[model samples]
Target chain A: MTNQKLYHAHIEACVEAMNACNLSYVANLKEYNLEKLCECIRITRECAEICSFTAQSLSQGSQFAGEIAELCAKVCEACIAECAKHNNQHSRECIEACRHCVEMCKDLMVAA
Target chain B: MTNQKLYHAHIEACVEAMNACNLSYVANLKEYNLEKLCECIRITRECAEICSFTAQSLSQGSQFAGEIAELCAKVCEACIAECAKHNNQHSRECIEACRHCVEMCKDLMVAA
Candidate 1:
């Protein structure tokens, strides 16, 4: 997740990035009519959801901010690796969002 | 988050729930060109994201499963209350998702 108020443009960027990964995952799976990459798709969805959740919790000042941020870092790393395989604007956007999330989560862990 | 492997239809249900909330939040706010509900929209995004992330982390057997589930409970509660104020199918779907997430989170906390 991200802080739009603080990071600026992160809101749109993150949403775009997430949507890109999700949309592509579902679309590709549907077109292929195979479940070969279902795990990856599922992970992408998870990555998207957690980032969104972490951002909100931080904004709301949730108590587990540190733990949440730590997990966010892990998920971000995974998602970044997955999204990087694609060569599209959405993948690019998702990579950026994941990168930003990784940085924020690391910072949060330290602050915690 | 949900467990499609265990919860059967949880995957579709959760995705539907989250998409409903995110779509409506962004669409309505954009159409109205009003920032009044921006906070709520942001929260909705957060709620959707966290559930997804939590589900994935649990599936992967993350170390902070218990704490993640606990935070999930709190966010789901807040989202339920906020989503309840809206009387629509999307809100209904979101409500179900929130309900499911709450139950799962509570159960996870207990098991932890």
Candidate 2:
């Protein structure tokens, strides 16, 4: 696939992962664990934002692609760690998605 | 402040930063740059999600806190790089917020 196509695909994957995290948070809301749920929401949102940005940066050949890649790795790691806490199916899926995105971001970073 | 408070505050900051990024993306929509705008939206959303998760993880002293911190750093860096391209007020603000969040995440990672 072309570089642009790859970047777009990566961003879409990240978005799916983040959406999974958000859904998990919402699902957990009824447990009155607002604190935990809220935190998850925040992290997932942040990851989604940066993932989107990284895809755009790559598509445009932005000068900051390398820097973005570095950040993407860190964020994905953080999200996975957070989701790992629940030991539930949703969290597990989130962890997997985050790991996938992290790897992609790292590859993009290297290429940049 | 207590560690819990600190974690909460950090999450809040990250949420704010991600929100800023999202708003920027929306603002740029009028330019018919769906590709760039969509990418930014996705990244901001992801960042927000992960930031929320990290805060919760730290609050609960999850084993994954360190991992989450690492991820946060990577995502923030990526967001900053992406936003740097616009040279507009919103993008610049997002970049600054992202940098601040990255620093916070790094500190959390070390502490974890």
List chain B TM-scores, each candidate: 0.74, 0.78
| Tens-digit lDDT string for candidate 1 (B1-111) | 222234323333343345545654554455463455566677788877776666545544456777987887788788888877766665676678778767767777786
Fnat of candidates, each listed: 0.00, 0.00
Taken over the whole model, the C-alpha lDDT of each candidate is 0.61, 0.68
* CAPRI-style class, candidate 1: incorrect
Candidate 2, superposed: residue stretches over 4 Å from native: A1-112, B1-3
What's the CA error at residue A48 for candidate 1, in Å? 11
How displaced is residue B21 in candidate 1, in Å? Answer: 3.0
Lowest summed lDDT over 10 consecutive residues: which window, candidate 2 chain A? A29-38
Cα lDDT, model 2, residue B89:
86
lDDT of 2 by residue, B1-112 (tens): 2357657756766677667766664565444444444455546656656766666676775767678889977987877777776767888888887788888887777887
